[model samples]
Target: MKQDNITAKREQEKRIVSLMIRTYCKGRHGTRQGLCPECQALQEYALLRADRCPFMEAKTFCSNCRVHCYKPAMRENIRAVMRYSGPRMMFSHPVLVIQHGIESIREKKRLEKENHEA
Candidate 1:
């Protein structure tokens, strides 16, 4: 993809992850729409990973990446946030959710094809 596309995708990923963390922290951590300290750290770490991702716009969903970049604890925290917020995304941010869903499916298929080829 073009550089512009990569930048756009990175920004989108940042936004999506930020929203998920914020929502999760607000409800479960009792922050009431704001992230608590732990969630704040997780969000920052997630954004850093997304920004530094080698595949950038070419990446599959982070869940499907071959190389796991996040540390175990942070990864689990993110997974929890995702599990809580993913379904809710459809209702809260339908456009972004749909786009990401489609992209995730496509990326999964692509990875499967590569695995088969290998």
Candidate 2:
């Protein structure tokens, strides 16, 4: 049961990150169809990280995660993608943005409580 939950969370993270990368690639790279080669590589790397995330059960999103699992260069690349894609997500994926915001807040509160307890 715990494994199932972790798998679901991982898949959801992958889906959201993939969407963000696709949006960034299309808007920035002017790719009319699927992701360009560069974005595709980034997407794959992001998904692999998500798959291996140790804090998947606790973290709501990569932005809220304290541990940086991504290598420096890939982390910078993902940051660029998020910066370009985040505001745009309001127009393209408002629901996801809202949900992510809510989840981040909840996760922050949960972590605070854990720290306070400890």
Candidate 3:
């Protein structure tokens, strides 16, 4: 993976996780920091996992990946945050929502191609 691609992926993951934290923490935890203590820890863990992703430049949305990297409890917590925040993202972070949607589609296609070739 190129350095630029790695950087871009890290930025994208940071943005997405940040949005999720903002939405979830603000709505549920009633915090302006965009994260409660637990969510803050989870966000840091998630970013770390994304930064070390094996696919590197080829990485897509974590949800679309064949590998499940997050720990079970953290995964469920993040899933809850995403489920609550995903729809809200369109209104709060429209550009990121759109970018992620496009990337997810591309990832799906790539995965399908890999499967077919195999």
In the range 1-118, model 3's lDDT, one tens digit per residue, is 7788788878877877877877898998899765788888988988888777876576666777779889999999899999999999999779878887897888788888989999
Off by over 4 Å in 2: 115-118
Worst 10 residues of 1 by lDDT: 57-66
Q: Arrange candidates, best TM-score first.
A: 1, 2, 3
Per model, state how many residue pairs clash: 0, 0, 0
- Candidate 2 residues 81-106, lDDT tens each? 99999999999889999998898788
Inter-residue clash pairs, candidate 1: none
Error of 1 at 7 (Å): 1.3
Instruction: State TM-scores per candidate.
Output: 0.90, 0.88, 0.86
Write model 1 residue lDDT over 37-80, tens digit each, in one string.
Answer: 89999999999999899987567588877789999999999999
Task: Give the C-alpha miss distance for residue 89 in model 3, angstroms.
Answer: 0.7
**Which candidate do you rate higher for TM-score, 1 or 2?**
1
Instruction: State residue 15's C-alpha deviation in candidate 1, in Å.
Output: 0.8
Residue 22 CA displacement from its true place in model 2, Å:
0.5
Question: In TM-score terms, which candidate is top?
Answer: 1
Ranking by lDDT: 2, 1, 3
Q: Which candidate number maximizes lDDT? A: 2
